[model samples]
Target: MESVFTILVLLTTVGLSGFVTRVIALKLPLPLIQILLGCVLAWPGFSLHVTFDPEFFMMLFIPPLLFADAWRIPKREFFRQRGAILALALGLALVTVPVIGYSVHALIPAIPLSVAFALAAVLAPTDAVALSGIAGKGAIPSNLRHILEGEALMNDASGLVALRFAIAAAMTGVFSLRHAFLSFVMIAVGGLAIGAAIGWLSIVLSSWFKKRASDEDPAAGVIMMLLLPFAAYLSAERAGCSGILAAVAAGMMMNYQSLRADMSIVTRLRIRGTWGMIEFVFNGMTFILLGLQLPHIIGSALIAAEAQGYTHMVVLIGYVLLVLMMLHLLRFGWMWGLRWLARRRRQRNATDLAVSGWRPLIIMTLGGVRGAVTLAGALSLPILLPDGMPFPGREMAIFIASGTILCSLLVAIVGLPMVLHGVSGKEDGLAAEERYARIEAAQAAIRALAETHDQIKVGLDESATVRVADCFARVMDLYRRHLEVLGADQTADEMARLDDQVDIKLRTRGLQAQRAELLRLRRRQKINDETLNKLLAEIDLAEAALFTRSRTV
Candidate 1:
């Protein structure tokens, strides 16, 4: 194990996992697989010599992963399901900590209340990325997915905040109700404010840099965009605010502001590719880390059991599992009851409401698996308490936290697929939606083209109008062909070829507009050459948005 290279082994695992996932359609969750792999690596003869710094692990991995999730979740869905999201993020975490704390203290009497609470806090929330990948495989409703994702995204921050407060209490040997309450409020509010401010600044800075770029090197503006999230997060953290929230806010702000008109197709492609890779690697590594830690966590527990006077760690493990089961049951019961109430209310009011089915709600609750953040918080537990004594039950607490997380991951990865299967497998609704969107877009495009042609016919001289009308007819025919392609009236090959031609024509027209603007500005001397470049970039971004919308349709 010492002779073998660690990085090479981890990378090999990642590559193998991906291959297994794609080739065999391995139905198991990737994280579960990764954790299993780690356990195997750590077992007796094959013990892969690996060590991780707690702070480095948390700071390096958590921020980017959380930020990416936040960035992808839409504002509309986030707000719509905010109540549920908050319930899970803040409210549920508060409930979970105490429940786990009480259960742990009862089952393992030697573990101090403070240490138990700290461990409880660590296992409070599940990993969103894991849930999404698992739940997304099923034909769950998009709105339900949004709620789960949003909740997962926000709860991670909330869980970390709780963990910090619990750690503070454990270290200082004092817990103040007022102080803890205030601290929670301050961290959440301050983090939000700072995140927003940083995000806005990043947008402004990125926009300014983009405007200053030369035509010969459009890619120069890209570097500023890449730096924005990191700068925003680090700066906010330095200013005594939550870096996680700050990173999320910056990513969300960039998603809204920078994705607008003026973004080149090339830029959009680059941004998507960059973020996709970031998300993939981060998720992959997280799973691997969790897997690697499993053997260590179990080994530590076994060693500590003798000193702690606990003969059956398995009994304690079972108790932890029971607590988790109860929490999930509570979640399911709440979701089901709330939805039933909502349905009744809608019926009484004679109002139409889109009810998110129960399957997703159930899956969402079960999906909570503790991840790297939990491990980080657990590891960060102080070596000593305020009285100069070793932190009570530190090793036992770590074992329990790690065990609960592993158990949660196992349950989620295995159970989610089964849960998804029972959910409505109907893609008809989404297919219908896609069809409707395409028809509407096609009709709207036709009307716009018709309107433009009408204006041209009216403005032109009688002789030129005929020739122009002929050109207009050709454009109309092309538009009709587009509609046919969308309607699936055209062959797939023909549609593909025509779609390429349509994109080329659109790009050509955009270029023509830029040329026209440049010529007009040069003649008048009212606008500088720089203005043309800026305006053209803006136009390109706008065009790219339209293209993106079309593709989605």
Candidate 2:
């Protein structure tokens, strides 16, 4: 009962945090707001405490969130930026683990080398979720954002794997480079293969069910979709593989399947809305949980530091700052080197490199903010070694991890805006693609209508055929006008665009009037509740479609 109550309280807080963020004058990011609310919940008066189980948290929160991100990321852009992503995700992890590992050991000799390596490994994965929250949506340039998102998706697995090996070494006091390398290769390959196979099977089964019962409710399909990430994560773990990468691979496979399948429109919309809510809630809960753990982590670490004859809290904070600075310098240097190599290979103008490189480098550096995953990894450190003694520096490591997360968020919160200020927003590059798609779709509709009309006219009487033809012509005319509005000629395009805008406004007003009348009918008991909802849903879907078209065109 207590566990259930704790969950209810957390959910209530998550919902209220959304409202508070909207009402408050500060305009703080939602994650930050949730974290603060969590801190308040941790007060003695509240006594709201939830145990942090790192493995369960990873299984519960990480898979679906990573899945959603992978599903939504632009596949072409992801592949295009694969080089940069791999450099940051894999190569940077390689560099950071050793460099930051040694740096941490040098700063705090009390922390063993293996433990320091573990800390550095956890810190290696940057949180794109936090980056998005702090930077605001579309605030970063499109290309840079894609690279960041890809890096975040891939590095979670790499960082966690590194942490695992470091932990093993710490517990047993033995390490082998060859064994680690072979294990990593097997884990990554097996994870991707398993996830893809499972994803493919789910897609095929769903398709079969749809065909077997064409009129079935979409709810079952949606439920299955919700379970795919968990299934992938669990399956990979059972196979001694990377569950993080498995979840990511599953999402990518689902994306591919979606392109191939002719899924129902209703199912597509339901899947989208369901996943959006899941991402929001899970992400909120993760951050809030971090906040809930903070006070305990900091207090315990401070006491431990005092015991060690380090009386000043500033010393610990200084360690966090030092770690953070090392991360920035290393990231900056790696990025600069990659660019220099690319320039030499491409023979690009030095002037172009000089003009355009620094801003993005800075943005990427600041955007490398630590988040929930780092905290989770830190907290997951073993409480006892093989000798049954307390694990060395566990408390300090957790404290430092928590501090780094907060400080990185603070840095990005302050630095990103100053960096991005006064930069003119670019027109969405995909607008042209959307317009072209709309035109092609409209043309296809017209062609289909004509073919159907020809087939229907053959079997009908003259008068019936005329009426049918008239109906078809009216529908076809709508498509024709859509095509005209998306015209290629400059002057005609401008005029048609204005005319299309007027048409949309008129349609929007008509929809509003219909909705008002429907509600009026329900109020006066002229229509039953069922009838009202049925009509209202239709009206809402229409409005949604119109709103989407307005935004794109």
Candidate 3:
């Protein structure tokens, strides 16, 4: 808890410094700035020491972060680009370990190969949130963007699994390929099964509660929702499966299932906003914490390994940069080869090849900053061997991994913007136009519905129809505004603005109606609780759908 407070204060300072730097037009990556700040604070006397703990860090951070990221990745895109994602997430990670291990062994001959392998594994996984700045810049095409995001999400799981195997082999003094392979399969599949079960049960529980409850308490429902990820993850791990994979699977499943549930537009908006803020804070703190850990690790290593002195440190830093560059080069080379083959196949089939945008691939590779998970894994390394001696090269290995993270962040921030500039000209204006066209189509549908309602009201008796006519008139006004905004070039923005206004109006009107109806029911003393609850649920569902549709578009 003290550490958490320290982290919050340090992060707040880091954020302010980053803002100051940006305001003055400095061009460093935010992560880099945070790392430097961490270093400065850790210098003796500043006293911002964070004692890294394995279990606490993993439990507090990884699951929710992974789940949130997986939930938002477009399921359709993930499937479509599954092959590329697999190659990078799984294949590239396998390639990275041995390559990085050998390179580090050559650079630091004193370090054991197992320790080097562990370090390599730590640095292999990419942090998806670290790329938010690049992605938010809107420099990549939709296809490439989705593919990059999918790759990041999948590789997080893949990398963690690989790291675990490497760690287990290091600790047990045995590395069985057969066991490792079987373990990976079991963890992944078992986690998936666990996640599915949790998702199913959650839905059942929520439905049961919704059916029997009389107060219509959505807060209770939201509480149940928060428990699913943690429950699925912890339960799977307790059952000898990957908690990381379980959390991801559960989140993905929940995101899919929740689409059909009854929710008010207000609730959805509130939830989205809440999750977005959570993710942002988590990401910012994760990077800052990673940065904060570096100076201490590196300084400690320098003191412990006195044989080679600062020269060794300098050489190791160079090696870390080499390994970092190699990571990017391999990913880029793999993507290039894959795209070339894809293009050849498309030509053979007389079909247009999907554009393999370079900027996104660049962003993806460079954005691979080893963060909280890597640090957590590194700290999890056994402190002592079976012979009662300290784990060989553990401190030095952590230093190298931390240094690699810094190098990766620097490269990404500096290189991504240039790549984006080179490729921004190729954006598909035609696609944007098509999206605008769809907005018009939806607006037209709404307007047509309003018009039909107006015509139907015209044929009714004036006394009986006046109230219904008034409703249609209000609805017609809404549709007219929507239609007017549809064909505009800023259609997405315009629709979003209109949708917000509608949500506000719906909330105000729905609450007023509910209050009035409740009074009427109380006066008559004849309202069935079940019927009244069902009506409320229906209103909530309609309100939810309005926001969902608007946002989805």
Off by over 4 Å in 3: 1-37, 40-43, 134-137, 304-307, 344-361, 422-471, 488-553
Candidate scoring better on lDDT of 2 and 3: 2
What digit string (tens of lDDT, one per residue) describes model 2 on residues 1-553? 9999999999999899889988998888888888898888888899798899999999999999999999999998888778888989999987899999999999899899999999999999999998988888878877778889999999998899999999999999999999998998899889889888888999889878887985847899999999999999999999999999999999998997678657877888888889989998998899899889998888887787687666557788889998999999999898888778767677333212222548878988898999999999999999999889999999889888899999999899899999888653343666678778888888888888989989888978989988997899877766776887788788877777776788788989999999999999999999999999999989999999889878855
- Taken over the whole model, the C-alpha lDDT of each candidate is 0.71, 0.88, 0.70
* Candidate 3 lDDT, 160-221, residue by residue in tens: 77777777777777898898889888987898889878877887777777678787456767
TM-score of each: 0.78, 0.94, 0.80
- Pick out the ten consecutive residues of candidate 1 with the lowest summed lDDT: 347-356
Where does the lowest 10-residue lDDT sum fall in candidate 3? 347-356
| Backbone clashes (count) for model 3 | 0
What pairs collide in candidate 1? 35-291, 126-368, 126-369, 261-541, 261-542, 262-537, 262-538, 262-541, 262-542, 263-541
lDDT of 1 by residue, 1-553 (tens): 4436887787787778776766665566666776677777776786576776677776777777777677777786687677666766777778778887887788778888877888878777667777666555445556567666776777766777777878887787689879887877777777777777877876677678768766635455556665666776677668776777777777777677656797776777777778787777778777787777777777776776656667577666776677668667766765665566667666422211125655566666676666767777777788787788898888777776777677777787677677776566445766787778877877888899889888888867989999988888887775565566666545764765567567766876876687687779777997887887787766767676656645643
